[model samples]
Target: MTEAFIPIFYFSGTGNTWWVGNQIAEELQERGCQAQPISIEQVTDDEAHELIEKAAMVGIGYPIYGSDAPLIMQAFIENLPAVTGQKPMFIYVTQAAWSGDGAYFMRKLIEAKGYQIRWAVHFNMPNNINADLGWIITMILKLFQAKLPHAAERAAKLAQHIVDNQPWIMGKSSFLSFGWTQRFFFRKGFDSSHKNIWSVDAEKCTSCGRCVRLCPVDNITLVDGLPQFGDQCNICLRCYNYCPELAILAYKRPYNPQMFGTQPYQGPVSEFKPEMLIEKK
Candidate 1:
């Protein structure tokens, strides 16, 4: 047999994880491995289990949310197939900060599934669109400068880690993902309870439909010249994040206050389109 290899996968929301997923998949192909990209966004538990049942080598890619895994990716890992034997699994993470404990969290989740994790790495991308002024300004720039060189460099470096089969930090990630900081993310400030859910001023909306078009999840509907949000928000924070009128949030984006003074990841602005992960077809 050439190699019974496949990367049964993930990566959702802002496409940071998905970008890492694509870069890894491309590298695996270049090494002559048959790799596939699986999206966890619209997938069901049964579908996830079915894919795992057929694969020996697996890769689970995701963006860290609140220092833990994204709610959706964690749920998928929780429902992953109960492994019959030890399997080699690879993990990839995409994040705005240098702090995501990707492999440590992956090892915990996969041990529950009865698999042995082989290696993993963190791939830094520009911060995802957030309800921050800098993010909005940077996003508009990305529309014109999609192929930023730094993003490609980060993606390539992460891809090299996978093909070279090197250990990526072992378990240092546990200190952060399962650490005290995870508790702080839920502590009042970053949580939804503290979120400034968008409000329409009614004086300047202009029924423009820009927010609706910009929303990744279609979470908003303009009702009589104002946007309405009913509970279904990915909280990628994009609707409010990229709003042009400065009408998106009365305050600043809730998560990061120091963003104005620092570059979160080691990169420049780059656009990530969600639909590029159709490697299955």
Candidate 2:
């Protein structure tokens, strides 16, 4: 029988992971393997599970949040239908800095669903820690422009390994391992206590409602032309990074034009339209 297809199931907050998934899919197809990249937000759990069952190989990619896996990704992995046997899977993470134990957590989650992890790697993209701090991230991205191409090159190399049917293992990515630094910095800085920390300044807000539409969790609602925040935020930072008016504030901090420096992921190679991720209801 011909080899089964490789389906890459990915979750991207802005677009970094999406880019990685698309690149991998392209390389696999070029090497004569059937491949498809699927977005986790656009599919139901049953649909994702069926894709896994029918695939000869699997790939899961997502951005690292709080030095841990995104809650949405964790939920999707947990809800997967039982597999008859272990399937070869590849796990990749996108991070600005260290990914902490995120890869380890993902490996465990996938194994729990009876999948054998063939690779656990990471892609270091531009940092998007606090979208409210866009200016800082902007400066950082400038310094990283010289090094960003390295990430894309590395992704191409990994794709070749898959095309060759090579068994590879890149576990607990560098600077991403669980340690005291991750606990003190990301765990504390990104804790759930900050769920209500976001505030919108009515004076700066133009009632554009961009935050309402960009939020992945539907946590923002427009009330009387002003945006309101809810508890469903995954802290993806889309609303804060993409806001044209700079109206959204995180941690109750005042919006400072000088200090704002966020470079959210924007280089998606695929033809995927992000607006389709929005729920129609």
Candidate 3:
């Protein structure tokens, strides 16, 4: 008999969603199912279509941006080829503070493509955006670190349920799901225009081309040994977090101040690998 294969498609900026997708993949494997975690940005449309076609189930994951789905994820969802019958699907969204309607929006997208949504889960992780909170940053890191065990366990259990074809539900918070008005406003106002907010410091940049390589959208180019931003950035902050020189700036006031540099999530998920998860008997 052919074994069931599950594919998890993730859009990660600073590796948060990648980590979550890996965790779920790990659990699915432990249950004797074949699962693979693939980064959406790393695959071409044809490759993505191939992955989806081979899978018996699908998993979609991403980090919430501007209280909604990141632009890249939206584009990926739109590009997916429709299925003949409904494919069982699950959604997982990670956010620093609030996911708003991010998971809801993604659920709708998946269902629109003839996928049956088995469940949608929201995870609150450390914010990747380097806010100038000083001492609060320490507190935030500590809190996220403390939540790792619970989050991993939740991910594993959810994946197990999917593997067993069992039903599970998460009573997500209502307050976190922002209204349509807010979603429309933020999606149009912030996410659509975020690419313009990034800037490169000519004095600080070493022309190492880290930002250029890290850009998921190919929205960066090197001109005269300095990185220049384009109009397609998804605000994933990969360049900001991965920059060794802290030269890339978001130019959004307190949200991206120069004083605070390279504030990426250093939580257990970021620090640990998926193989570290133990399959509970």
Candidate 4:
């Protein structure tokens, strides 16, 4: 019999979701399933449709931001082609703390498109925000590393459930559903802005165009060798965390670079390269 083919589409801001997706894929493969982890940023709409059409099951992974999936992942889910047979699907999310109904929110969205959500899991990962916290952040990252084995074991269990056709659902409480409102307000505050709140320190910027290349939504562009930001920012923090020189400046409001300083994170894995997320044309 042919092995089941599963494609996991995931979005990672600073590598937490990417690492989890890879772990799940590896576990699934070890269980005699053909699993591939595809970056949401890299997959074209037609390519996504083709993969979903042929896959035995679909997986979605992302990091929780403000108790919700990132804007990029939400858009990807919204644009997905509706399936007729209610294809089985699973979801996983990585977060630093409680995600409330993050997984459930995504389940409802996918269900609206005629997908049956078979399983949903959440993993707590190292906090990517508040990088400027210095030593406190270091301790948190150390804790994440210490718990790595347990996380991997959980991933294996998730894979095993898939292999056995077991149903596991999480974050389904009615009380937790308040996270949907939180997500709505969060998106309205950050995503509805017509003004750009991203900038670069010209002196620190090397004109390397890394930010332009790494932005998942193509909201960054090079203008005369300097990176310029558009109003379509998803606020994923990929460019800010991956910037080599800490040149990228993000403000809570327009024209306020001093509001938050840049402190680039090196990602969860030592060998992670920002360019790896870029789609090869």
TM-score of each: 0.69, 0.83, 0.82, 0.86
The digit string of per-residue lDDT tens for model 4 on 91-145 reads 9998876767888786666888999998988888766664333456545544543
Q: Positional deviation of 93 in candidate 3, in angstroms?
A: 0.8
TM-score of 1: 0.69
Question: What is the per-residue lDDT of model 3 for residues 134-203, given as tens digits with 9 covering 90 to 100?
Answer: 5676456445422556668878888777867776544334665544556778767775567668787788
- Give one digit per residue, the lDDT tens place, for model 1 in 123-213: 6565655445466765563453234355566556655665566655533644555534663664444466433556665654577776676
Model 2 TM-score (2 dp): 0.83
Colliding pairs, model 3: none
The CA-based lDDT of model 2 is what? 0.70
Give the per-residue lDDT digits (tens) of candidate 2, residues 177-260. 543356457656656465776888888899988888777767899998888888777777778766777777776765555443
Between 1 and 3, whose lDDT is larger? 3
lDDT over C-alpha atoms for residue 202 of model 1: 61
Given candidate 4, what's the lDDT at residue 168?
79
